[model samples]
Target: MNPRTMHSIFLKKKRTMVAIAMLSVGSISAQTFSDFSYKGNDKIYTNNPLKENEFYSPILQGCYPDPSITRKGDDYYLVNSSFSMFPGVPIFTSKDLVNWKQVGHVLDRPSQLKVEKGGVSQGIYAPDIKYNKYNDTFYMITTQIAGGIGNMVVKTKDPAKGWSEVQKLNFDGIDPAIFFDDNGKAYIVHNDAPPKGTEQYNGHRVIKIWDYDLEKDQVVAGSDKIIVNGGVDLSQKPIWIEGPHIYKKAGKYFLMCAEGGTGGNHSEVIFMSDSAKGPFVPATNNPILTQRYFPKDRRDKVDWAGHADLVETPDGKYYGVFLAIRPNEKGRVNHGRETFILPVDWSGKYPVFENGLVPMKPKLKLPEGVKNKTGKDGFFPNGNFTYIDKLTDKNLDFRWIAMRGPRENFITSAKNGVKVNPMETNIKALAPVSALFHRLQHEDFETSVSLDYKPKSEKELAGITCYQSERFNYVFGITKKDKDFYIVLERTEKGESKLIASEKITLSKAIKLQVIGERDEHQFNYSLDGKNFKNLGGPVSGDILSTDVAGGFTGSLIGLYSTSSNDIKP
Candidate 1:
């Protein structure tokens, strides 16, 4: 045979081998995706029954952060920070740690603490709730806005009766956790205020446990001891360690806490010691829970993942509850930090974090005999409305809140609509006195308000709006623009206003304006008469409702607002 013919035969054989290898790789990849059944919405399937040892299942949805759970016999009660939302500290009850129901709110009374000036995202910080069986009292501690280091506590025998007046604690810190030792010695563990030098209000990364005296109302036992200051590594400087809680089992003390910033760097760390007050040692494994090492193929990427609490079942199983943020289409975290649950085990001297980096898909078994309850369809029967008396039973839902602290003189009930009296203050400085707001909980929920607006001056703008943040908002109102009574749609950003829509329309002595939001977007529609409607250009892409983006302690709120500096008589 010729030499050139032999070379051609060898080249063809090499091509055939390469094609076979590529086919084998593609077949294996297809099997991997099929085995997981991975899809959107972070849903996973497993053949095993739900037990107390599975990892990676989101327990709650929406911004349910800083979870504090207390197990009372077979029932468990959990509470999270509500921030500026009226009726703060939402309380949820569960039996098997899977299904939960919002039973009531802890901070609803006026004496709880004023949050109007605290701004949106700054009202309440981390809250710790615990029940003292011997005293039959429920105790909760939370930091008040503008108040210094220490937090305030509220106690009540019955959660239905609500909490009592806020009692300020002596310690200067946030994330206050209460622990009652087996010997009946009550102690408080918390993070200390940041020392000067690092980020102001962001340096002290230590967990201190002190004896708490209920009668004296102060922490007295131990001085602030630095437990784990990022393990003496300056490269990881300014690790903001907060949210400390202690758990003891089998004569070993487990101190769990949050570390790093509360954004993408958030994580949970565990320190163990034989004594409560000790030279605690960080687990050699370290960082029991974190997103930095997340698996490559997980459907959801958790940004902020920390602030956890541990709960025990009646049959002696351990579970850890924490919060994390799941990203959305725009690469933004609109859902905020939601609550999650994972089963844990103690192997050797430290708790082994199973499926720590991979999002756990646990098969949760709902507790027997517990029924899921739906949100109230209408307003409370006894709730007093200012403008419209006798609201539909489903009118007043958890979605509603008053801007600033609500005042009695600002609103009242009437036969036609809810009567809102313009207050003698500017909306920018003073909290919107008569503003009634609710969360845009659903991405495509529409909100419309029909009210009689009597603007006393050009400065007084009264109507409805969909606010994204302090820097961005869209409003529809009847205003005196260029000495003409015109219906207009205004867009305000960083306190600067631009008229998006303006037309000469007859302004009634009283007119109604309506605003509708859809698909996490918004549209401005106005009405001079109750019948005719005009569509304003909208559907802008931005955060329709969020705490992180909107710059408030509460979620995206849609409500009625009236702003005026002049005192108007009703």
Candidate 2:
């Protein structure tokens, strides 16, 4: 063949290869898996046996920020920023860091806080937990910013039951961390906004360590000594430093903290000092874990990763538990600030990043001697009678949280399952008092609630809702139209509620509706006998259920709701 003919054939082959590559990219992009899914029925507990030199960690779910963990004997306890969400300061326990169970809340009573309209983002900030061997007490310091209150401490021998009345710590700052040295002395470290007139709560701040009086519940000595001042550095502009946890190991004090904003640029920085109060030295290799170091390939970009705490295992292994966000197709992260565990190694006198500079994805290894029994209740367990009993526990699962702050008389125990009374408030105002909900725990899980509703008036609405917020919500309930039974599906976006789907239906003395939420999709089905079902196909679309769009301090919740112009009495 001539040279011209060969050139033409080469061009054709190049064009064909380019087309195939583009098709492959399109196919890969078209198919993506949901972040949270049912990972089969594997019983992996926190304390299960581990092979030698094996790494184990937890699948950090929800918004767990400013994580403070303490190891008491072989057991570990962890707490995060509850913000305004009630049952504040969720306390989790695990024999190992891998598997954690919701033990209880540090604050259960209303007197602990008066957060009515702060929504979910204003109640509690990062809290530090410590065990006082001298008094044999567990001390926790939480910051309540909505009330402009200083830090408050709660003590108890047992954390699972309840805590004492909050002992007010008269200190001004946000993320409060408590450090107990081996010398029987305690110090409190926190980030304070620049005096009063300087600026608002911007980044330019410092970690101040003060001699704290546990008995007096106040800072006894030491001025606000600027320990590590990253906020002053001009290079890292808009320096928002917070979430400081102090750990003393091998005669060197490590101040591990979250720097930059809690959003995409969030990071975990480590500093070292010879004493509790320091001219702390920045770790030669700072920002031990961050997205800047952990690059995302073609899969997903896990951003806003920081706010970490270091925990040592029973067998002397160091692990860091921190929060990170996984973005969706729209570049939004619904599973906000999830907790993750990565191993850390000691190099020379300081800690070094494992697996080069990139964040190490170590193989998870369960601890020795534990049991995990997840998903033994069979698929679609809403109809299972035993599963219904588990939902009524006063210790509400981490899967559940109130849309607004929870009211005292909102939810009560009924003979059947749970009873939610209507509050005398519209869904638009502060403390709607009408909604109770749980997190959309699984992507493809089915949730159904049985409630016998007798609408007192045309305004009263009671039913089950998948609520992200007031503006973005889907409600399925019985509307009082000519006293006729009808199931209605309402969708709200940008504070506007539109009736998406409604159908007339016959109901017996009782009514039940089950919502099957698929991968980024939802379906509402009604059943009178709880056996046979009718599919109500009125699909709703909004970002409220998607964590990336509805920006709040908490996750999506599914629960019973009742709204009324007058007070609802059961």
RMSD of each: 21.5, 18.0
lDDT of each: 0.58, 0.62
How does candidate 1 fare on TM-score? 0.74
RMSD versus native structure for model 1: 21.5
Q: Which portions of model 2 show Cα errors greater than 4 Å? A: 1-60, 195-202, 231-234, 293-297, 352-363, 368-408, 432-434, 528-537, 566-570
Q: Mark the 10 consecutive residues where model 1 has the least summed lDDT.
A: 29-38
Question: What lDDT tens digits, residue by residue, belong to model 2 across residues 475-544?
Answer: 7776656666567777766677767677776665566667775446678887778678887755545366
Taking all chains together, each candidate's TM-score versus the true structure is: 0.74, 0.80
Candidate 2, residue 72: lDDT: 84
Q: Report the Cα lDDT for candidate 2.
A: 0.62
State residue 233's C-alpha deviation in candidate 1, in Å.
Answer: 6.4
By lDDT, who's the top model here? 2
lDDT of 1 by residue, 268-330 (tens): 888888878766777767678877666544554555677888887887767777887655544
